[model samples]
Target: MTMPQMPDSPGTARPFSAELWTAIDPVYAAILDHPFITGLVDGTLPHDAFRHFVVQDSHYLRDYARALAVCAARAPGEDDVRAFAGDAAGAIAAEQEMHAEFMDRLGGSAAQAAAQPVGPTTRAYTSYLLATVYGGSFLDGLAAVLPCYWIYARVGEALLAKSSPDPLYRRWIETYGDEAFQGVVRRVVALADRTGAAATPEQRAAAVEHFVTTSRYEWMFWDAAWRRETWPV
Candidate 1:
């Protein structure tokens, strides 16, 4: 389903993220229709596809933590650095605990998860994040990382409201939809706004470009998992 149009008034709206999500609402709306997401939420997703997702996501989160660390390193202020650093630590911990638990239930062992080759789209998505973090400005890195948090929160709430009957899927939805996660999204959105406000027009434009690119990758990543994508070789 297409995302509903945003209302025209900032006076009664949540600040910061409204504009950023608005710019890319269509991309996110398409995400709602992706088979991987729909099937997962509705409990009809093939277990193998979900397994592939868990493995690939396990790999992605590690590189994601590294990318976030890179962002922390490039932070313009101590506060930004601290916030990103904390988030990086959170990402790292999830692999060890949360991902491990889910993978265990799915018959995935740590060694196996580690041994599996990263899928093509997983590699591309993480590479883009790292590239943006390493080569682009601080604001650019922020924009790139925002979708990981923002999209999860948005999708989580949507799926959670449907009251998924699948325990695994419900757990996943609550993980993102919970109050704590939303708080983090809010803080990151505020940070993005602050970064954009201080950046040059060129820098802001570059950041938006990165945001849009990453948003598309978010869709591609799910579609890749749905297909259980692998290298042709």
Candidate 2:
């Protein structure tokens, strides 16, 4: 099924998701220009850097699945409950295969990747997400997790226009650039719009803050991989 687009207009009141996206447009623009992202486009990224991303991302997804399960439990309606719950499962089951595939191509096994320590940025980003989902309202959880879905879909689509010649890099791009993944993101975006529509002013404001913070984390996650972020102490 096709996901509906969120409406945004300067002259009219926009949906909460639209507002959130507008608030982070600058951040997203910067992300598009980031070296990490451009690396994927041109196949210039280092092998170890991409390996670092795959390892850290495997860890990130496990915790993100937990956060989504929290969202499912806190959701107001059965449809949303099912959506988040199913996505939580998909994160663990379906997406894990993709990660493992990349890990293998990068000369590592799932077991080896599992033994790798999570990068500092990965730890911080997942911690913030888990904290928001457990401590804040359902709307807040939705906002906190939105960028992972939305930003990847946007980045994937953008990179698809000039896909890397490297087969491994191209596969990574194709994973997120797939229409199925985009539809999943659109569903989450619609949920954010619906939930945001009913939120109090304070809640809406909180959602915006969470949205921007996580969007920034999205950038940091890629940058972390680019820099091969690690613990100093």
Per-model TM-score versus the true fold: 0.92, 0.94
Q: Highest TM-score: give the candidate number.
A: 2
Candidate 1's C-alpha runs over 4 A off are 1-16
- Residue-wise lDDT of candidate 2 within 1-233, one digit each (tens)? 33334566679767887788889989999999988889888888898989988888899999999999999999989998999999999889844698888888889799898898988999999999999999998899999988999998988888877999789999988888889999999888888888888889898999999999999999999899999999999
Instruction: Kindly report which residue pairs in candidate 1 clash with one another.
Output: none
How far out, in Å, is residue 180 in model 1? 0.4
Question: Which tens-of-lDDT digit does each residue in 58-96 have in candidate 1?
Answer: 899999999999999988889988999999999988878
Using lDDT, give the best candidate's number: 2
For each candidate in the order shown, give its overall lDDT on alpha carbons: 0.84, 0.89
lDDT of 1: 0.84
